[model samples]
Each structure stands twice: as structure tokens, then as C-alpha cells.
Target chain A: MLGEINLEKVGISCFFLSYLVAFAFEVTRLIKKSRTSRALMLLFAVAGLCAHTIFLLVRSRAADLPPLVGSQLDWMLVLAWLMVLFFLVYSLLDESSALGIFFLPLVLLIVGSTYFVGQEPRAVMEGQHSLKMAHAALLVFGISGVVIGFVIGLMYLVQHRRLKRKHGQAGGLSMPSLAKLARWNRLSVMLSFPLLTAGMLTGVGLGLYSQRTPEPVQLLDPVILSYGVVWLVMAVLFGWLLRAKPTAGKQVAWLTIWGSGFLLLTMIGLQVLNMDSWHS
Target chain B: MNLQVVYCTHHGTDLTLREKLAFSDEQTARAYDHLRNEFPDSEFVVLSTCNRVELYTAQESAKNVPTHQQLAEFFAEFHKVPREELFDDLLERTGPDAVRHLFSVAAGIDSMVVGEPQIVAQVREAYATARDHRASGPLANAMFERALKVGKRIRTETGLSEGRISIASVAVGDFGKSIFDRFDDKRVLVIGAGEMAEETLRYLHAEGVRDVVVTNRSIERAKMLAGQWGGTTAPFDQLDELLGQADIIVSTTGASRPIVSCERFQEVRRQGDPKEVFILDLGAPRDFDPAIGEVDDNVFLYCIDDLEATCDQNRKVRKKEIAAAQRIIDEETDEFMQAVYHRATGPIIRNLREKWNEISQLELERLFGKLPDLNQEDRDHLEQCFNRMVNKLLHPPLEVLREEAREGTPHGLMDALKRLFHLRD
Candidate 1:
């Protein structure tokens, strides 16, 4: 019975259902933890990851392009894939950490948003393959870092509130120390800002270079315009962070949350509206 | 089945009495020798700590199990206390109860400060010392090995061992650690040289805070506190300057009013290295002004009431986990007891099976001789039938014996089996 189901037929629904179940199990642990529930949670998460990998590979094979350049749907899935990888790594390293609860909902939304986004492949201009690759890779990584920072910020706030209230650590809700969270949050923003800026610069070069080509990227399109706004917000936050004094951990956490959260929301909201994205 | 424990823990005994009863390393060797002489057939392990002094002993035979009175007399003799006075203080448990008590102690549920990890190391070291002295046997080794695992299991599974309970520990662990990453690079300024200051200093030293400065009105007391902690002493009048220079301040001074007001702290902050400061006001009268907690974003201040409340919450948290921990201990205790009972019944059961199988083999050889004319297949079939019949007949008695062993050593059933089969030891 198990062997009858073919791996080649794996689809988004396959992994999507697995992740949905895995998320449910994770919630069960928070409500009432047991060894069995934790085991099931890990099992479903691993199964979902395997299915997700297979689906991505199969879809890339069908499209004759890498998932990053396949479409907006593929782009969102790739983002979710990176985050799921991070979530699994974090959850595996620390069994008691509450990363799954905060991380999974975001991953689910990112993956779920793929259904609403366009599947038309993005453009890869002549003689600019490497630049497009670099742009795609850098932005994917930078966005991943932003998502990680946002998650860590949320955790910092939760732990900070619990500490401020003088509450003992609740079972199955283990969080990192505020100092460690703050340090990671700082590094994520610091590292991702440079990558994002480089990605945006490469994108601009591609757009300017495309002016002489047959199909030029829509530089002032709604997608690009909204992305620019998000980038501006991040730039402001990064500048302030660099110039600011050693502020309290709570303030830093809030800033990271709002800054990263805004960038993600604008990108997703624009893609969901089916605006004329630059690559389309 | 022969295991026993006689102990006086902080739960029931006075601190003075426990201090007198606690065995030092030098005394433990001598005590082991004395116990060996008194009970040559028994395995012994002596666990001596500030909060508890337990004597875990087991014997190979139930008949050799030492009496409670004899063990009480031993403690009285060893401690040089009068027998009658020490007898009532020392409580005793035998068999399953004794195993449960050890598991509880190992898991930290029985600790005065529930969830303190020091007891696990203390128990491990005690067992190792007993092994070194050739005092521990297989039963004691099995119990202690399982006990260490039980401690780890309980710690991982339940929140019984989570969070810090003491005021000093909470101040350093809950708040101080949250603000600063490491302490070795930070300067520690301890005010007043009181007991609370000393305790907090000990925790800080453990966290690698080496640069310590103690100040007080009496230079002598300050010098003593500084000397004990390998730090320097500052004059009390230099409090403002010291406050500015130090990154972490623990003020336990018994002052009538707030020594470091918010205005004074802000003024001092200007001269200070503009870095984060952690102030733990462990003083009863609220030294360093509660208002200073909100004065600067970099300044994290916690007073006595704040730390005390956290400690109380920590205690309540530990109390809530006791039920969970007790469940684990109960389950492990039953499992351990069942294994012990099976170990006790092992030799008898093995001999019975071997003896009965020997009779079956001999009878089969005779029957084959009588049926020499039969075909090979027929003879083989008969032999299989006989073997099956022997196993089927023995199954019921063996099942009964195993069931009986789960509760305890099935001594009566084993004796009856030996007699009925005319078996030798």
C-alpha cells in the first residue's frame, strides 16, 4: 500500500496537507504536551519537508526552470521552503524551544499564498542570466534573514514580557534568553540589509540594461513601487539602528518586528493583488 | 528485596543535627571500614550533604537485611551522639519504599531547594566513593545507575528542575543574565558587605565575575568580604565614584533612605562609561531608589521585593511540578522493584528449567531404545510430542512464579518447586 503511491506524482497539496497536520500537532504540544505528541509533530514536520522537496524538484523539472525563476508561486514556495528548513533546524537543535508555534503560522501563510499568486514564469533576459541568478539568490536570502529576524523579535517580546512579569518558564514554551535573542536579531538585520541592498542594486542594473532589449522590466510597476517602499522602510530602520545608542532590548525587538513585518506584508499583499510584477 | 535506607533529611531534621551527622571524606572511609566490619555481607553507600545524610545498604539475602535499630545504633555510634537522642531523628524504609526514596532524592524532588542540581552530583560522587571502597555490590550499583538516569529523565521531562528559587539566584539568573551576555568582563560592586551581598557575590563569581569591589562603612568588614572573594576594598565615601566605575552593583546596605537617587544616578551616569548597568538592590530598605529602575533605558534595576516575588513564584512553580515528578518516581520505583525481584528469582528459575529439561532428554533416549523398529519420522514425531508436553506442563507454574515475582521474591513458590521436582540448589 505504501509503495503504490508514487513519488513522481507528489504535488503542493501533498506537502501542504502534511505541513498543516504538522502545525496542528505542534499546537497540540502547546496545549498539552506529551512525548507521543512531540514525536508525531517531528514526524509530520519531516514528512512535510520531504514532500515539499520532491514537489519543488518535480515542478522545476516540468517547467524546465529553477523554482526561483519559475513564477511568483514558485518564489513564495521557495521562501517558505527556506523558512521551514530554518524552523526544522532550530526546532531540532532545541527540543523545548517554542520556535515552531511562531514560525509555522508564517510558513503556512507563505505556502498558502502560492495558490492565489500567478504561475507565469518570470523573464530571464539574454546575456544577463548570472545577474538574474544573483538577484534572485540574494533577495531570497535577504528576505529569509528578515523573516528570521521578525520571528526572533516576536520571541524576544514573549520572553521579555514573561520575564518582566516574573513568571517561571511555562512548560513546552521554552524561549532563548533576551540577550541571545537580541544578539541574533541584531545580526539578522545587519547581515540582511547589505544583501538586500546589493540585490536591489543588481535589479536596477538589470532594468537599465533592459531598456535596449525587446522586453524591458516595468521599473515603475506597482510591484516594484511597493517593494521600493518596503526597502525604504528597512533602510530607515537600518540607519537608525546603526546610529542609535545601546537601547533596551524591548525597543530593539519592537523595531525589528515592525520593520521586517512591513516588508513581508507589502511584498505578499502586492503579489496577491496580481499587480504587474517586474519579472512578469 | 533486601535494600534499605536510613536517613535524616532537612525535611524533618534540624540543621545542627544534620551538620553533626554529615560525613566528611576522611570520615567516610573510616565509616565504610566500620560498616564493613559490622555488616560484612551487606553492600553500603553513604550519602552525606548539608541537607541530608543517607545510608543506602543492601544484602544478597533477605535474612541478612540489617534491622532499623541496628542502623540507627550505627549512626549514633558513628556521630558520637547518644543512641536515644539520635534514634528518633533517623527515619528508615525498606524494600520498595527505600528505592522510591533514593529515586526521589536523585530527581531533586526531595531536596530542600527543589530542583537544585547539586544533589545529582553529590549522589553520583557518593556512589563512586562507595564503589572505590569496595562497599557497593551489584544491587547497589544497579540502583544507583538507574537512579542517575531517573534524575536526568525527570529533569528533562518535567519543569520540577526549571527556574531559580533563591533571591540571589533569581537576581543573577532571571534579570542580570537577560541584560548582560557575560560577566567576566563586567565590574562587580558589592555594597555593605552583608550576607545577602556575599551570597550574590558567590553566584556572580560562579558566572565568572572576577573583578569585584566591596565597600562598607566599616573598612574591616569590607576587607573581610573582599578578601574572601579575592577582590579589593573601597572606602564607603567613594560610593558614587565606585558606582560610576562598576557595571554591576549589588547594594545590600542597611540604610534608612535611598542611597542612590534617580537624580544622583543620572548625574553619575554622565561620568560613567555609557554602558548598560545591572543594579540588584537586595537591601530591605530599598537602596538605590526604586525610581532609578525607570530613569534610563540602559539602567536595569531590581529591588529586594522584585527578586523575592520571583523567588516565591519559582517555589510555586516547583511545587506545581512535584505531582508530575512524583508520577515518574512512582513508575520508576515499580519498574526497579520488579527487576530486583526477577534478579532474586533468577537462579532458582534457571535451575528448575535445566533440571526438568534434563529429565525429558533422558526419558526420550529410553523411549527411542524401546522403539528401535519404528521409522526415523515416527521417532522424530514422538520426540517433538514429548518436548511440547514438558513445556506445556511447566508453563502454568512458571507463569505463576513470574506473576508472584512482580510483587516480590516468590520465595515460597520457588521452595515448593524445588521440593516437588526434587531439585538441588
Candidate 2:
């Protein structure tokens, strides 16, 4: 009966299959390009995005909560949905650059991870107050910045490599120059630091508030400590960037990629392992 | 239709041949008169530039059209050059290739600098001059107008002309622009009178750099170069002093050794204003020391290599655009071929349709005379049914002929259609 039912059994696979098709269309443009082909590529992407949005909405409705706050199923799809939205808007503005080459893999990773990662809701976050809700929202947004910064830095390095080697700009694989990428990376760190700091502060406040209630929240957990360390690294980068005379765009891009990339890996690793303070 | 272009382009000829064959505006008018007198049925438009000398001719029939050898002979006689000397340099393209070539040239896809904006203006000027001399026909008018539209489309729809790809331009437009908002107040010091130096000075002048000081190893050369560009000449000995005062320094000297050493430039930097300075080193071994680029944050030094890499990147982008533009050309070529083929078969198709209708009318008239008691409405309905059946029977063969038109003129099929359809012309 469960296998035969369409809504619960088939929605996730159906939406994900569309994304795979859209990704294939984006790749196909490199070989056979036409105005119609380009439009079709966009059409597939929008189609997949519509299906993805619907699937997530249905899951949230069935679970009776905001998608990201509901369960692992909701959280993973929400991240992927945001990524697709960002890629679609940005790619529409500048169709020449290969933004999909970098961001699509991340979308796939999140979508793929949902299969392995369980869908149990964290008991602590089920009926959290407004301040606790603010903490989770801030953390998600902050992590999103770090993830984006990593991707941008990776693109900068690739562009810089092409320039340094004197190779022609590869067809269907152009990106912004190191100069522009570095500027974005620096801004990302600047923005991510303040948001992350506020998120951490709010988290601490929520923890203290929850300790007075029955749960007795732990402040010195490993996940909390690792997050603090990631915040500290961003703070250092931000301070150095502001004080330095002028760093080369390439050097800054490399540093941001390395630093932010490590933080992102740790965050994702924490989520996957379900260890440290973040365990349900 | 007969269309021909006798062109000495950069592909087949050198600047010397182009120059010898080039016709100024007054000379072009005289040539037009000569052409009209020699071949009254032909239409002519002469395109003369620093790089190309082309004479395009169009006529209603191929019999009056000039051959390749005849065009070469004309060029020799007109320019007073020997026939042997000019014969090899003149290349010819006829009919469809000719139209495609002209379209590419007007679009700048065939230019040395792909997608350069100047060629469109050159083409427009050439067309206007031809019109003024009464040298163009309906075909030339239509062809040139369509070429202009294609040029506009290639420029606006594609990123073919997005960046300046020359070293002189990249240095001034990219790095210089990033440093200073305006160059009108900047002191431009050019350290050589080479072609590169002249080109850099021209760009600077266009950017409104007024106070240009030219210094070369040869003062006479510097003075001559500066005089031509309307700039002051400085002595070779005062190169360091000139460098100190220059807000923007462009060195294209042919010195084997480094002209501006790290220490020498640092010394000049000490005397100069502590403000930012833009240096363009356009030498092979590099006129300025490579370490000079790292001397200070204010000194924005770009050597030939850096500017060259950027130029090369832009060339690659243009190369990509060529593929897109070629696709458009191929599509247009097929459509043009179809139209020309259909025009070729127009007489036979019209005659066949008229002949069939006459036969149907005669047979119907015979039948109606035999059956005079039949009603007028019934007779008319029978005639309509018979006409529809005739059209349906002719449809399949005619469709094949139309499809064949997309290749060449479809001359074989047109002759075959005439025989089978009992079409007379």
C-alpha cells in the first residue's frame, strides 16, 4: 500500500530526477548551443525548481512545521532549494559564466545526503521559543555564506590558474576574474562574521534561558566549541582584510577558500556524524 | 543575377598593393564614371581602406560581368601598376560567396581585429559614396542594408566586442582607467618614437592627456614623432627628469638593456609627487625592470606580457563568437539560395499553371455544350471539384522541387519539372 501511494512514496525521487535532467541540459549547452537550447535549459531548471518547491511544501505540510525546522528531510531540501534559487537568479542575470559548474555539485550533495541522513526531528527544537528559533535561522544563514564563499573562492582559483597559464578562456566555462572574486570573498567574510557572531550570542542566550527550564543546556559541547573556533577564524580574516594595505585578489581568494572551506567541512561533518553538542 | 567583388584584402595582398589600388573619394567618382561608360548595365561600389581595396559590381546577367583576369587588368590599368605585379594580388568571389564575404566584412568578422567598430562605418561610408556617384542598384542597396543589420545584431546580441584586445588599448583602457578617472590633467611621457609609442600616445591623446613629452635615444626621431602628434619633445638625456614629472609614463624603446632600472626608477619616484603613477612598459626585454612592478602600491606598472595575455584572452572570446556568427551566415546562405532557385523556376511554374487552367476550361466548355439542360450551380460545382483534384495531383512533385532549391540553383530539377508538367516557356 505504501509503495502504491503516489504522494508520500514518489515525491522526492520525482523532484530529484528533474534536477538531474536540468543539470544534464546545462552540460549539453557546451556542445550544441542555440537560443532554443539555452531557453530549454532554463525551462528545465525552472521546472525542476517548481517540482522541488512543491515537494518541500508537501513535506512541510504533512509534518506541520516550517520545512527547515521540521526534520532532516526538510532541512536538506531547504538548503538545496535555496542553492537552486540563487543559481537560477544569478545565472539569468549573467548567462555566460559557468556558475552551474560549481553550485550544481553542492545542490546534488545536499540532495544525495538526504538519503543517508535520517529524518528524526531534534526533541529540543520541536517547541522552541522565538529566541531559539532566531538562533537556528541565524546559524543556517551563516553556514550558507561560508558555503557560498568556498564556491566563489574555488572559481577564483580556477580563473586565476587559467590566466596565469595563458590558456584561452575555455568554452562554456568562463567565470569572473580573480579581482572580482576576491572582492566578493572579502565581503562574504565581512558579512558572515557579524551574522555568525550574532548567531553565537543568541545561541548562548537561548542556552542560558533553556538551562533554567527542565532541559539544562550544555555550553561547552564540542560542536559549540568548533563553531566558536570557526567564528574566530572569520574574525581574524575580517580584521586582517580591513587593516592590510591591499592584498592581491588571488592570495585573498586562496586564503578565504582554505579558511571558510575548513569551517564548512566541519559543520557538514558534524551534521552527518550526529556527534558533539548538536546530537538529538 | 551577376555579382562580383575584385578585392585586395589583408588575406591575399599586402598594404603596398592595397595602397596602389585604393581610390580616394574624387578618384572613386571618376572610376564610377569610367565603369558606367565601359559597362552601362553594371552597378559599381569601390571600397578603399588602409588594408583593402575592393570593387564590387552587380548586373542582371552574367554575360556582361567582368572575369577575374579582366578585373586584375582593370586594376593595373587604373592604378598605372604593371599587370604581372597586380594580377596575383587580386582575388575574386561571385554570387553567394561574394554576398557572404561582404556581410562578414561589414560585420567585422573578417577584420584583423574581429568585431572592431570601425568597419561598419567604413562600409556605410563606402555605400554612401557609391550612391552619390550613382553607382549602386536595387540588389546592392538591399545587400548592403541587410549586411548592416547583421552587423548590428552580431554586436548587440553577442559579447564579440565586449573588451579591447590590443596591448596599447588594454594598458590604457584597463589599467590606466582603473587608476585615474580622467587623463586630461595627466602628464604623458613617451620614451620612444616607435609605432607602439605612437599608438600609445594616440590613445592617451584620445583620453585627453594634453601635456605629452616625447624622449627617444634619437632626438630627431622624437621631435618628428612629437611634431606629428602635437606634443613637446624632450632630449634623451633628460629621460629621468621627464619620468619624474610624468603622471603616466609609456616606454616603448628598442633598448637591448633595461632602460629604467629598479634603482633608477626609485630615484625618480623620490623626486616625483608621492601620488600614484601609471607605467606602461611596452618592450620585449621590458624597458622597465620587472621588480619595478613590485616597488610600491602607487606605481601601477604593466609590462608587454601582462597586457598581451589580456589581449590574447579577448581574442579567444572573439574566436568563440565567430562560430555563432558562422551559424547565422550558413542559415542566411541556405535561404538566399532557395530564393534564387525559386526565381529561376518562376517562368516555368507560372506557364504550367496557366496551361492547365486553359485545358480545364476547354474541356468543361465542351461538356457544358453537350449537356445544356444541366443546372448552372451543378456545372460550377463539377468544375471546382475537377480543379481541386488537379492541384492535389501536382502537389507532391512541386514540393520536391521546392525542397531541392535549398542547395544550389536546382537547375536540373527545374528542367525536369518543365518536361513532366508539360510546362512551356
Fnat scores for every prediction: 0.32, 0.00
Q: List where candidate 2 sits over 4 angstroms from the true fold.
A: A1-48, A110-116, A125-128, A155-168, A177-179, A246-255, A276-279, B62-134, B138-165, B169-250, B263-279, B291-302, B305-335, B351-376, B382-425
Candidates 1 onward: DockQ, in order: 0.32, 0.08
CA displacement after TM-score superposition, residue B378 of candidate 2 (Å): 3.2
B-chain TM-score of model 2: 0.78
Residue B193, candidate 2: C-alpha displacement in angstroms: 6.5
Q: What are the C-alpha RMSDs, in order, of all predicted structures?
A: 4.2, 5.9
Error of 1 at B200 (Å): 2.7
Candidate 1, superposed: residue stretches over 4 Å from native: A1-9, A20-43, A90-97, A122-127, A155-168, A172-183, A214-219, A246-254, A276-280, B25-41, B60-65, B77-80, B133-138, B270-274, B346-399, B414-425
Which lDDT value does model 1 have at B108? 94
lDDT of 1 at B269: 84
Q: Could you give candidate 1's per-residue lDDT for residues B124-228 as a string of tens digits? A: 999999999999999999999999999999998987877788888888877777667788998999999889999999999999999999999989999999999
The 0-to-1 C-alpha lDDT of every candidate, in the order given, reads: 0.86, 0.76
